[model samples]
Target: MASDSLLLTADFPRTVRGYAPSAVDEFLRSLGSRLDALQNQLDQQAARCEKLTADLSAQAKELAGYRLKEAALAGALVATEQRRAEVEQEAAGLVERAREEAEGLLAHARAEAEQIVGEARVRADQLVAEARQARQAEEARILDLCAEFDAAVETMRRTLEAHLALLPEPGSTLAELSLGGLAVADAPDSLAQAA
Candidate 1:
């Protein structure tokens, strides 16, 4: 760990016999030169290591950010999948409810239609019966009128015959008596003809 200045400035103890000062100085200088070269190489390596460590630190930070992003993306995917499932389930439930409501409405409509048809049939039958009864009543009334007319004609004919019988003989006293513009003798024949 000695520096070049430290090696040059070093002191040695005097002895009866010892290594030469110049030789020691020459060896010290050579060792110092080698150490300087090694130190330069070591400094270069340390700087490279520092740069590599900085790059690694930055890469680690970037990697951590990427992991955070991945986790967030994964969580988002899971939430999205769950939302989709909920939506699908809700849609299915809505469809089922709609179908049930439709069926119920259809059944109600069918029942209403049937009731309408049945009521219509009953009303139609009542109308037809009423018409038939009215027609029968009209026919009976017409028949009664015809019978009354015939009975009135018969009564008139009988009254006329009785009056003709009360008249006198044709050429005797009946001729002397005149009834209205006709002679009494002709009254009986006129009455009979009228009857």
Candidate 2:
């Protein structure tokens, strides 16, 4: 049906001589072979176009999948950035607190050290005062003992002089008799000088 227009039609007149039969038959056969080659070329071109269309559709689908993956990765990157920011903020807060605590500890240590030094100074002063008092008291006791010794020596000298006045004169027998070389002549003078 599609090749109807290309077909050769015979219109021989009833009174005129018709075309040569062998030549017409040869021309028809050559035309039919050319038509057949043209139809084969058209069918090949259609098959190639269909394969190209199918390849284009597959490429479009692959492009859509890549776009979806890119969008998902973008969202994940944004979330990671947000998390990093939060962690940094928290670390900063902790560092600030640690610094404040360290400062407080340093201040407390300084105060304690000062207090200890003050107490040591007070104790040292008290010890020096006590030693000075003890030294003064000992010196006073020594002076009192020296005074008592002098008083006892003075009383003994007076008693010896009074007892010598009660003895006999030097020309008497008692003065001639030696009693372990005890001469009473210079007794008062020696006792006064020794006292």
Candidate 3:
């Protein structure tokens, strides 16, 4: 029937001067046992090969996943570097703008301060000129007053000298009285006219 069963069944015909029947049967039985042992060993070796192949396939898949992760990490690193460069450029621009603004403010402040100083100088000059003019006017007025006072004093001195010349001497007083009231009255008229 089955090939396996056919191989298990063994029939050896006996010959008179040939192999012994018991010895030939014993040899066949030992060969069957050896063949079975060899078959079992072959089956174990096939199972081990299959297991190793499966492990190799799983390892290949893991390697591919690791490669993908590495690629992703590389891309992320490149992107981070680019972003850092962009930020640095923007910061530099901002710093430049701030510096320019500060410079402009400083220039404007200097201009304003200069203008204020110039105006102050002009005002101070004006005040000094006004004070000089006032002092000159006061000096002129004082000089005029002194001149007027000197003229008044000179006029008074001349008037006093003329009045003194008109008066009689102490010895002439008796002669004037003896000459009568005419001389005394005439002397008063001369003094009044001179004044």
* TM-score list, all predictions: 0.35, 0.32, 0.37
Provide the overall lDDT of each model, using Cα atoms, as 2-decimal numbers. Answer: 0.87, 0.79, 0.82
Estimate the Cα RMSD of every predicted model relative to the unseen true structure: 28.0, 27.2, 28.0
Worst 10 residues of 2 by lDDT: 4-13
Say what the RMSD of model 2 is. 27.2
Error of 2 at 35 (Å): 1.4
lDDT of 1 by residue, 12-52 (tens): 88676998878988898888888888988999999999999
Per-residue C-alpha lDDT of model 2 across residues 6-40, encoded as one tens digit per residue: 55553334435776776776687678667777878
lDDT of 3 at 150: 100
Q: After superposition, how far is residue 164 of candidate 2 from its true place, in Å?
A: 99
Q: Give the candidate number with the greatest TM-score.
A: 3
lDDT of 1 at 101: 100
Worst 10 residues of 3 by lDDT: 174-183
Best prediction by lDDT: 1
